[model samples]
Target: MMQRFIPLGNGYSDIYELMYIGRAMPERVRHMLVLHPFDENNPEASLALVMKPTNPGNFQPIYICLEGVPIPSKRYDLWRELADELQHDVIELTVSPSGKFSDQEIFFQHLIGILRTNHYLPRLQRSF
Candidate 1:
């Protein structure tokens, strides 16, 4: 399946938007992801929404906040609250910072690699 990450800015307000997407489309929410990536020397956390692929298409989307928040636990708490409300648990992963790469495209590629390696993402020759 094809995957895409929809960046929704930083934390706080954007997090609310992320939660809203879950509430709005409960069926589409395949799962949630909490990505912890260090920014420079400061470690931070972020949230993402993994959406179910559309019918007749393999386009699955993962909405996230590329820039992380100062408090990892706080972001995780927000995700917890969302999980409590949704009655679904989110998958959490610690990854290398986007800053490691030269640009966003490469950063996303790195993330895609991490996910696939962890079996979170379908393999290259995956059967659909």
Candidate 2:
């Protein structure tokens, strides 16, 4: 299987797009993730939707709003709203701040490692 992070714009107005995708492909939705990172101060959270592999294809796409929304835990309404809309359990992972990485590619690699370590994603394989 191939996994990839497909970055969405920050979760401002772009949240609507995320919601639309979920609603449109509810069956494909596998897991919902909220990655939180903090430095001296709390930064925006990254919201992601993990979709199951497509038929005739083994691509598991993780769609994300990369860092720029209020932490849902602090905002009960938004959290509840997301939970309700997703209609599935959501997993929260606290992670090192994105700033710790020198670049976006590095940040994604770090996230992929975290996901694999936590058993949220499959271990890398030479062949599927």
Candidate with top lDDT is 2
Q: What is the lDDT of candidate 2?
A: 0.79
Off by over 4 Å in 1: 38-40, 72-75, 125-128
Model 2 Cα lDDT, one tens digit per residue, 1-128? 88889887877777768777888898998888888886658667888888887787888888888877786444324644766777977788888887788998788889989998998888887763
- Distance from true position, residue 109, model 2, in Å? 1.4
| CA lDDT for candidate 1 | 0.78
Q: Write down the TM-score of every candidate.
A: 0.85, 0.86
For model 1, what is the alpha-carbon lDDT of residue 104?
87
Pick the TM-score winner: 2
Alpha-carbon lDDT, every model: 0.78, 0.79
> Candidate 1, residues 5-118: lDDT per residue as tens digits?
888987767888888899999888877778878455847766788788778788878888765666545666877888888878878788888778898888887887887788
The 10 consecutive residues of candidate 1 with the worst lDDT sum are: 66-75
